[model samples]
Target: MPNQRYTNQRNTEAPMQSSIENLSRAIFTVNRHAKTAPDPKFLYTLKRQALEKLLAEGKATKKGLHFSKNPKNSRQQSDVLVSAGEYFFHLPPTKEDFSELPHLGELNDHYRNPKANMSLSVAKTLLQQYANYYPTEDKKQPGKKTYQKPIFKRLGESY
Candidate 1:
């Protein structure tokens, strides 16, 4: 779940500046998966709206993003900030990229968990690490087929 601090109180309006910061951190964390997927799914309509709006505000950056205060308004039906770029619709899924629902559902699922939220900069670094860890190792087929090694694909390695 997202930090309750981000929640809106019925009678009190939280300070905007601090709320914005909280929203930033929260949004970044939630979008971490979006940054790391082999082929990112950034096609959601809401994400695109957020991205364009932030870009217009000159707030878009490789590591930083602008977010709405209470995103629930659109989803849970509450007035909340949806992170910028939260709605850029991705091209329709294809066998070439993936076989699934529209990018909107993909991005939404990534950010569905509050734990998913992490600062964009941190998320980017973490994603890079994950990619490096599971690099596509080169593979050489033996005269005969075999699949016994955990690291099955690599140069000059026998299974």
Candidate 2:
């Protein structure tokens, strides 16, 4: 009976460990592709939702904040650093994050995330499942077009 209990405990731990690893890999793949994706809104949303779920489950930790490399409108910005399963990622900081987490200054260019071999589609699917994210289709009315007046330039007039 003692031996059976020990084996059962080990069995449960193994799957949990592997699941975390798989999730981390999926996150890495999603993050990588999101950087260059033309329509990255959905990808970024998926990553953020997954990280939030992991944090809520006590599977991930907030490390600190780092200055964003690409600030919008030339204004300064920062992101929250999160650690999970030997992987690190940055999430958009909330108002509380500015007060609660210490700023880590600039991002480390030398450090890189571990290489993951998962496909983009697989990664998206895995994250969607884990994050419980269901994308809703945009409900635009068919054949609806807004008309714009055409601008005509006067011939040879600098006015």
Candidate 3:
């Protein structure tokens, strides 16, 4: 049988060895995470490293690479959390050791800068959506089908 590797080291390392750890420490004002309280950096680093391998879709875990009814392995496991827009992901009992993983949308703002992403057409469409949601009586009912105006209109106009 193959030898089972085991110890305080195996596919994992000290927190100081990872950029994620360093990043975590910086993101959180705690100064020291594992030794301190819960920090947002703990979330970022955990997700930054485990995002690819930690997805379970319908379930949550306090362990890395965890699922079903399997046993826990703290030596190579750590809890983590991730947030994408309104969505939230979590990994309890977080640890740090990231050598593989890439940030999502890291360069999305490059070609599509803040100003570039905001096009006149898109602005018009968004405005129209909210505009239609307003409650108003038709000034001149064309044929009883009825149309409405923005009775409570937004105070400002976009260019």
What CA root-mean-square deviation does each model show from the true structure?
A: 19.3, 11.5, 25.1
List clash counts for every candidate, in order.
31, 0, 5
Worst 10 residues of 1 by lDDT: 97-106
Model 3, span 1-159: residue lDDT tens: 479776663332322222332222222222123234353443334333433332333122222222212236634332333432222333343234132322231112233111122232332233223223222354555666656765664679553
Model number with the top TM-score: 2
By TM-score, the better pick of 1 and 2 is 2
lDDT of 2 by residue, 43-128 (tens): 88999999999999999999999999999999999999999898999999999989999999999999988888777877787888
Poorest 10 consecutive residues of model 3 by lDDT? 106-115
lDDT computed for candidate 3: 0.32
Whole-model lDDT, model 2: 0.86
The CA lDDT of each predicted structure is: 0.37, 0.86, 0.32
Candidate 2: which pairs clash?
A: none
Better of 1 and 3 by lDDT: 1
Q: Of the pair 1 and 3, which is ahead by TM-score?
A: 1
- For 118-147, candidate 1 gives per-residue lDDT tens digits of 445443333333223222336554577676
